[model samples]
Target: MATQTYDVFQVIADPSRRQMLQLLSEDSLTINALASSFDMSRPAVSKHVKILHSAGFISIQDIGRERYCILNHDGFAEVQEWIDYFDAFWKSKLKKLEALLNEKTGSHKL
Candidate 1:
Protein backbone atom coordinates (compact mmCIF):
# COMPACT_ATOMS: atom_id res chain seq x y z
CA MET A 1 0.00 0.00 0.00
CA ALA A 2 1.07 3.60 -0.62
CA THR A 3 1.02 6.37 1.99
CA GLN A 4 -1.51 9.10 1.41
CA THR A 5 -0.39 12.68 1.86
CA TYR A 6 -2.40 15.47 3.45
CA ASP A 7 -1.59 17.77 6.38
CA VAL A 8 -4.11 20.59 6.45
CA PHE A 9 -4.87 20.03 10.14
CA GLN A 10 -1.33 19.27 11.22
CA VAL A 11 0.02 22.58 9.89
CA ILE A 12 -2.28 24.53 12.18
CA ALA A 13 -1.68 22.32 15.21
CA ASP A 14 1.37 24.32 16.26
CA PRO A 15 0.95 27.76 17.79
CA SER A 16 4.23 28.91 16.28
CA ARG A 17 3.22 27.74 12.82
CA ARG A 18 -0.13 29.51 13.19
CA GLN A 19 1.59 32.75 14.16
CA MET A 20 3.96 32.41 11.21
CA LEU A 21 1.00 32.07 8.87
CA GLN A 22 -0.70 35.10 10.41
CA LEU A 23 2.41 37.17 9.87
CA LEU A 24 2.90 35.89 6.32
CA SER A 25 -0.69 36.71 5.44
CA GLU A 26 0.07 40.41 5.74
CA ASP A 27 3.18 40.24 3.55
CA SER A 28 5.89 37.92 2.24
CA LEU A 29 9.17 37.94 4.05
CA THR A 30 12.54 36.27 3.83
CA ILE A 31 13.35 33.62 6.40
CA ASN A 32 15.83 36.00 8.00
CA ALA A 33 13.34 38.83 7.87
CA LEU A 34 10.68 36.75 9.56
CA ALA A 35 13.07 35.44 12.17
CA SER A 36 14.44 38.86 13.11
CA SER A 37 11.19 40.04 14.69
CA PHE A 38 10.82 37.02 16.99
CA ASP A 39 12.82 36.26 20.13
CA MET A 40 13.41 32.69 18.94
CA SER A 41 16.53 31.69 17.03
CA ARG A 42 16.68 31.45 13.22
CA PRO A 43 17.03 27.67 13.28
CA ALA A 44 13.79 27.44 15.26
CA VAL A 45 12.00 29.64 12.74
CA SER A 46 13.51 27.57 9.94
CA LYS A 47 12.09 24.43 11.48
CA HIS A 48 8.65 26.01 11.59
CA VAL A 49 9.09 27.03 7.98
CA LYS A 50 10.02 23.47 7.06
CA ILE A 51 6.81 22.22 8.61
CA LEU A 52 4.78 24.88 6.82
CA HIS A 53 6.49 23.96 3.61
CA SER A 54 5.63 20.32 4.11
CA ALA A 55 2.01 21.24 4.77
CA GLY A 56 1.79 23.40 1.61
CA PHE A 57 0.97 26.53 3.58
CA ILE A 58 3.89 28.55 2.25
CA SER A 59 6.34 28.67 -0.64
CA ILE A 60 9.83 29.98 -1.00
CA GLN A 61 11.31 32.01 -3.84
CA ASP A 62 14.89 32.70 -4.70
CA ILE A 63 15.68 36.35 -5.16
CA GLY A 64 19.30 37.43 -5.40
CA ARG A 65 20.57 34.71 -3.11
CA GLU A 66 17.80 35.33 -0.61
CA ARG A 67 14.73 33.14 -0.19
CA TYR A 68 11.37 34.80 0.44
CA CYS A 69 8.47 33.10 2.10
CA ILE A 70 5.19 33.53 0.27
CA LEU A 71 1.92 32.54 1.88
CA ASN A 72 0.34 29.72 -0.15
CA HIS A 73 -3.17 30.58 1.02
CA ASP A 74 -5.06 28.18 -1.28
CA GLY A 75 -5.04 25.67 1.59
CA PHE A 76 -7.09 28.00 3.78
CA ALA A 77 -10.28 27.32 1.83
CA GLU A 78 -10.63 23.99 3.57
CA VAL A 79 -10.24 25.59 6.96
CA GLN A 80 -12.83 28.26 6.14
CA GLU A 81 -15.18 25.64 4.78
CA TRP A 82 -14.87 23.68 8.02
CA ILE A 83 -15.53 26.74 10.18
CA ASP A 84 -18.49 27.94 8.08
CA TYR A 85 -20.41 24.85 9.13
CA PHE A 86 -20.83 26.42 12.59
CA ASP A 87 -21.62 29.91 11.29
CA ALA A 88 -25.37 29.44 11.34
CA PHE A 89 -25.32 28.42 14.98
CA TRP A 90 -23.19 31.38 15.99
CA LYS A 91 -25.29 33.74 13.89
CA SER A 92 -28.47 32.58 15.57
CA LYS A 93 -26.91 33.01 18.98
CA LEU A 94 -25.82 36.53 18.11
CA LYS A 95 -29.27 37.38 16.81
CA LYS A 96 -30.86 36.11 20.00
CA LEU A 97 -28.41 38.14 22.06
CA GLU A 98 -29.19 41.21 19.99
CA ALA A 99 -32.91 40.75 20.55
CA LEU A 100 -32.40 40.39 24.29
CA LEU A 101 -30.20 43.49 24.37
CA ASN A 102 -32.77 45.44 22.41
CA GLU A 103 -35.47 44.40 24.79
CA LYS A 104 -33.41 45.81 27.65
CA THR A 105 -32.17 48.99 25.93
CA GLY A 106 -35.00 49.71 23.47
CA SER A 107 -32.42 49.45 20.68
CA HIS A 108 -33.56 46.20 19.04
CA LYS A 109 -36.52 47.64 17.15
CA LEU A 110 -36.17 46.56 13.55
Candidate 2:
Protein backbone atom coordinates (compact mmCIF):
# COMPACT_ATOMS: atom_id res chain seq x y z
CA MET A 1 0.00 0.00 0.00
CA ALA A 2 1.69 3.14 -1.16
CA THR A 3 -0.14 5.42 1.22
CA GLN A 4 1.35 8.48 2.88
CA THR A 5 0.94 8.32 6.64
CA TYR A 6 1.38 11.22 9.08
CA ASP A 7 2.39 10.57 12.68
CA VAL A 8 -0.94 10.89 14.50
CA PHE A 9 0.89 10.26 17.74
CA GLN A 10 3.13 13.25 17.16
CA VAL A 11 0.10 15.42 16.38
CA ILE A 12 -1.99 14.28 19.35
CA ALA A 13 0.83 13.72 21.87
CA ASP A 14 0.57 17.12 23.56
CA PRO A 15 -2.29 17.69 26.04
CA SER A 16 -2.72 21.25 24.75
CA ARG A 17 -2.94 19.99 21.19
CA ARG A 18 -5.50 17.40 22.22
CA GLN A 19 -7.66 20.06 23.84
CA MET A 20 -7.31 22.25 20.77
CA LEU A 21 -8.53 19.35 18.64
CA GLN A 22 -11.52 18.74 20.90
CA LEU A 23 -12.52 22.37 20.61
CA LEU A 24 -11.96 22.40 16.87
CA SER A 25 -14.12 19.31 16.49
CA GLU A 26 -16.97 21.02 18.32
CA ASP A 27 -16.75 24.28 16.38
CA SER A 28 -14.57 26.37 14.08
CA LEU A 29 -12.82 29.01 16.15
CA THR A 30 -10.49 31.94 15.73
CA ILE A 31 -7.07 32.00 17.34
CA ASN A 32 -8.17 34.57 19.92
CA ALA A 33 -11.33 32.65 20.76
CA LEU A 34 -9.37 29.45 21.16
CA ALA A 35 -6.73 31.07 23.33
CA SER A 36 -9.41 32.38 25.68
CA SER A 37 -10.44 28.82 26.59
CA PHE A 38 -6.96 28.03 27.93
CA ASP A 39 -4.55 29.77 30.30
CA MET A 40 -1.73 29.66 27.77
CA SER A 41 -0.29 32.67 25.95
CA ARG A 42 -1.37 33.62 22.42
CA PRO A 43 1.94 32.61 20.89
CA ALA A 44 1.81 29.25 22.67
CA VAL A 45 -1.69 28.57 21.40
CA SER A 46 -0.64 29.72 17.93
CA LYS A 47 2.26 27.25 18.05
CA HIS A 48 -0.13 24.40 18.81
CA VAL A 49 -2.34 25.49 15.91
CA LYS A 50 0.73 25.61 13.68
CA ILE A 51 1.55 22.00 14.59
CA LEU A 52 -2.02 20.90 13.92
CA HIS A 53 -1.92 22.80 10.62
CA SER A 54 1.38 21.20 9.65
CA ALA A 55 -0.05 17.80 10.53
CA GLY A 56 -2.97 18.53 8.14
CA PHE A 57 -5.50 18.27 10.95
CA ILE A 58 -6.48 21.93 10.69
CA SER A 59 -6.73 24.75 8.16
CA ILE A 60 -7.24 28.46 8.65
CA GLN A 61 -9.89 30.47 6.86
CA ASP A 62 -9.80 34.21 6.92
CA ILE A 63 -13.08 35.75 8.07
CA GLY A 64 -12.47 39.51 7.86
CA ARG A 65 -9.64 40.27 10.27
CA GLU A 66 -9.93 36.94 12.07
CA ARG A 67 -8.78 33.55 10.86
CA TYR A 68 -10.93 30.60 11.84
CA CYS A 69 -9.49 27.18 12.43
CA ILE A 70 -11.39 24.50 10.59
CA LEU A 71 -11.01 20.81 11.31
CA ASN A 72 -9.65 18.82 8.39
CA HIS A 73 -11.39 15.53 9.16
CA ASP A 74 -9.47 13.72 6.41
CA GLY A 75 -6.45 13.72 8.67
CA PHE A 76 -8.55 12.03 11.38
CA ALA A 77 -8.93 8.94 9.19
CA GLU A 78 -5.24 8.22 9.75
CA VAL A 79 -5.95 7.56 13.41
CA GLN A 80 -9.19 5.76 12.60
CA GLU A 81 -7.51 3.32 10.21
CA TRP A 82 -4.75 2.60 12.70
CA ILE A 83 -7.30 1.96 15.45
CA ASP A 84 -9.31 -0.25 13.10
CA TYR A 85 -6.26 -2.46 12.65
CA PHE A 86 -6.00 -2.98 16.43
CA ASP A 87 -9.75 -3.23 16.90
CA ALA A 88 -9.91 -6.33 14.73
CA PHE A 89 -7.15 -8.01 16.70
CA TRP A 90 -8.65 -7.17 20.10
CA LYS A 91 -12.17 -8.19 19.09
CA SER A 92 -11.07 -11.66 18.05
CA LYS A 93 -8.93 -12.10 21.17
CA LEU A 94 -11.80 -11.00 23.40
CA LYS A 95 -14.21 -13.47 21.79
CA LYS A 96 -11.77 -16.32 22.24
CA LEU A 97 -11.17 -15.39 25.88
CA GLU A 98 -14.90 -15.26 26.48
CA ALA A 99 -15.29 -18.72 24.99
CA LEU A 100 -12.46 -20.08 27.15
CA LEU A 101 -13.97 -18.54 30.26
CA ASN A 102 -17.35 -20.05 29.42
CA GLU A 103 -15.78 -23.46 28.97
CA LYS A 104 -14.06 -23.28 32.39
CA THR A 105 -17.20 -22.00 34.14
CA GLY A 106 -19.65 -24.23 32.22
CA SER A 107 -22.44 -22.71 30.06
CA HIS A 108 -24.97 -22.29 32.88
CA LYS A 109 -27.04 -19.13 33.39
CA LEU A 110 -25.95 -18.71 36.99
Number of backbone clashes in candidate 2: 0
Provide the lowest-lDDT 10-residue window in model 1.
1-10
TM-scores of the models, in the order given: 0.61, 0.63
Q: CA lDDT of 104 in candidate 2?
A: 75
Instruction: After the best TM-score superposition of candidate 2, give how far the Cα of residue 71 lies from its true spot, in angstroms.
Output: 0.7
The parts of candidate 2 lying over 4 Å away from their true place are 1-6, 77-110
State the C-alpha lDDT per candidate.
0.84, 0.88
State the lDDT of candidate 1 residue by residue for 1-110, as single tens digits.
33345487777887888899999999999999999877899988988888788678898899899999999976666878778977977999999999888787885455
Residue 56 in model 2: shift from native, Å? 0.7
